[model samples]
Target: MSEAPHRDVLITGIGLVSSLGEGLDQHWAALKADGGPRPVVDRERFAPYPVHPLVQLDFDRQIPKRGDQRQMEAWQRIGTYAAGMALDNAGIKDRTDILSRTDMIVAAGGGERDIAVDSALLTDILAASDPGRLINERLSSDLRPTLFLAQLPNLLAGNISIVHKVTGSSRTFMGEESAGIDAVRTAHARVASGQSEICLVGGSYNAERLDMLLLFELGNYLWREDWLPVWQRLSRGGGLVTGSMGAFLVLESPAHAAQRGATPVARLDGVRAGRCRRGPGEATAIARRQFDELVSGLTGGERLAVFSGATGAQPATSEEQVFLTSLRHADNHIPIRAVGSIIGHGLEAQFPALVALAALAVSHGMLFAPLDDSGCEADGSAPIDRVLVTQWGHWRGEGMALVAPAG
Candidate 1:
């Protein structure tokens, strides 16, 4: 049997929603201006856990008003909004043509509980001892659909399909912290093999939830006030780049898009996934090797900027720092942009969205400033090329950059 011909996938449209703002215009402008996470006026929103900066998004504009809004969860809403915006930007009004040729792949971290809670409220009206608050505060047009099933992990992708009436193949995969890379890898293989012409791939997290914050703290993965000791030991504080939410891109073959008269925005180069070197003091060393292999397939050092998976934890951040240090040593001196700081650690869903944001920056010549923290500084030994302005007591470690040779 002969193997299918490989094709070059191109990104033609981009849509993004984050605390920084909604739509690519807002996000791209903010990125160039170096915007940080939005202010959380409702600090009690995630009470009982140490406070962390979160990426805030405007939900009102993203959710549809009529039928579409009636059928999805917040996470689904995020994905749908982004996908629609991206399609629109790509000059695709009716997705039928693209839908017939593409598949949907999603990377999700959380929000199933929100669906359950909403369902419980709808079905058990009598169980609502506090109907006053529920009626006044929690009502949504989206919650009215009894037939809608948004609790499933795949609901984000499913909702997109339903809205677009995309009867093609759709699948959602779960990959703990690696889901972002995993989703891209899945899409890359399918597109490369001619199984799909386009892939709407991204992830989203309801990180503002109190429950998630508590869970992260329980795992000792959160950065709270007590991390002051850890911060003190650091030679360089990182930048904050919060703006969590979902991002979607219209990814299709360059040939197919050209055949359809669509302009390309960026190339969906390639993605690699595997455990980086990290254990005890060797965290940085492992990360360096891992990232090196990640870009190894690209020939001739194509000026590459990395969107690192920095979780703001001791091991994760330190390993990332080592990776950046290695890049500097190789004379790459690539800039590092951290998104998790602003968006909080989104776990599974964070990477896909961050990838979209970084890709936008790479193709557009913008570098979002990290949230500023006077006390926080980059690791002196690491040789970071740029600093994202970060807020005080906040740490930023995830990085996204463009591919460019030493300037």
Candidate 2:
């Protein structure tokens, strides 16, 4: 017997929600406007710490039942809704046959904690003479057992399956930025190797919460005081502004897409994900290697563009900029857009978001204007035939993906 013929993977649909707004049209309009209202940041609610909040969404459109919406946490709701959008965009939302065969891969983090119960328990413990006893009582009586299950990372995948009829094999990855990168890599490899024909891959992050804000501030990673575009934040303190975002894409083998008459936004050439030990300039070293591999047969010049997912976290962000500058100086002086500057960092959702944006840019045959002004990202207009999306985690991972016009 011969090995199955290799397949070409294409990004056929996208569902993205962020501070820039919901859907590709809104985000495209904002980016295409060039320097319109910059990314919407909420500096008041979280005080000095800035966050990119989610746009107001009528949940009924995708998540029809109030009961379903009520049980899921914000992140799960966001992800499930985005998956619905992707299915709809691919013209398969109601196609039971395709929906049954679609494999789902999600990148997610542990579920949100119950803030009210936590606060009450802490407050009561402070007033009680027997603090330990009081805590034990509260643990058994106040906390619901299901709360633990609610926080499981896999719940996002479960919710997506229940809300939408994606009944195929399901898998969820959990390591922040690295998780998102690996999820896309798996989806692309599966489609390319003929292991799977259609796959939905992506994740979500909710940044407008007190618990997450406190969590990041513990590491001094939250941008304080005011909002600066990601590239400009280093001058102030160099911290990341988390965003509420949900991004999902429908990937299908070229043959599968053609059979269904589905239009592809772009072709997924390859995805490379790896981690650096953060040893002296290792992020850039890894990125340089991955960049070289990703841009293999592509003509270098203005026709190629780079979309960066650099979180404003120090050292890493600065290091990535250095790599981009190096690429530019090396005659790959293509247009660069640090998307985090516009929609804020989405953690596990960030890389998928970049892939979605890159596909849209290639599909339109144009590059969006620069979101940076520190002379780091240059501005230009070009009919982009290829795009390289990159991300360096605040602490460890570095990844890249190459996308091109679908032939």
Candidate 3:
């Protein structure tokens, strides 16, 4: 860490892909539109469990080589593609001189599961008189040894390095939503502290697979049948609808970006992440502390807003609401956009996605229409100056980030 003076961290570029669409322009257009098409969501695809499916993309645009795209699973391809988009957005994709120095920090979950093997094993287990032996038989006979290796979480970063030529120091973190929060947090800290000049950080998730839905279904954490606004899902046990998305960000020191003639989208003021046991008021308390600390740095109210990574899961989402309501009581009146209402839950990628959306809102000098007319989310009128991004994971982890206009 540098002691002389920490550099200001700027969001020099952002690359986001979600059910909304690919690229920032598509997302902005979809969000700001008044009453045309609603957010992209599919109800009948997985039946009972409605999901926000990703749009069909031409992978060759970002990932030029057919071989590179073939080696990766859906999540890896999505991440590699988005990473290239970030580099291009920063105007450094072709500048190998700068890319060789760009560090990368990725937050990722496990690779996609093999549903066929799982289903066969389950079927054998149900029919066999000796269930344990049947399970072992399927594990030995049906599963390929190489299958697990292909799903390694770090492969996302590895694929990015191979496909995009970003060869600086690389790091990967895995822990669901907190992984995302800390990925951005660490990248900002590195830039601000002079440990690194520029960093590419984010993650991706493929939620369309039955494996992910089944994983959550086992835990009773999946929304059923009809799709509803995140705020309105409480009536049906408050579960989440999965969305496939890849979110990557280019973070650079203010001096570094200016030196390279790169335009910054917004300034990252602060980020704080923590964990709270599922106790009564633990998550809310930690969240409010982070919110107050981050908001203290803003110069004025200036239509400040919060883009929340609420998973529509119980306890965490409700506690986050408590924190927001507390802010309102203090006259902060910072409106919130439950981003999951639009993009669904991307788990490990949720926090970064919200941060991306927050930066976009501030850069555009306006926030989109209220996601729901419910009293919780208020419409945005004035241009945004400072925005807060909040994340409370389904099981644990509470995080916050402040993205403000680049001076």
Best by TM-score: 2
lDDT of 3 at 91: 92
Q: Between which residue pairs do clashes occur in model 3?
A: 48-225
Candidate numbers, best lDDT first, in rank order? 2, 3, 1
Where model 2 places Cα greater than 4 Å from the true spot, the runs are 1-5, 146-151, 300-302
lDDT of each: 0.54, 0.86, 0.85
TM-score of 2: 0.96
Estimate candidate 2's RMSD in Å. 2.6
Clashes of 1: 32
TM-score per candidate, in order? 0.72, 0.96, 0.94
Instruction: Give candidate 3 misplaced runs (Cα > 4 Å).
Output: 1-5, 125-142, 146-151
lDDT (Cα, 0-100) at 209 in candidate 3:
97
lDDT of 3 at 145: 46
Question: For every candidate structure, what is the RMSD over all alpha carbons to the true structure, in angstroms?
Answer: 7.8, 2.6, 2.4
Regarding lDDT, does 1 or 3 come out ahead?
3
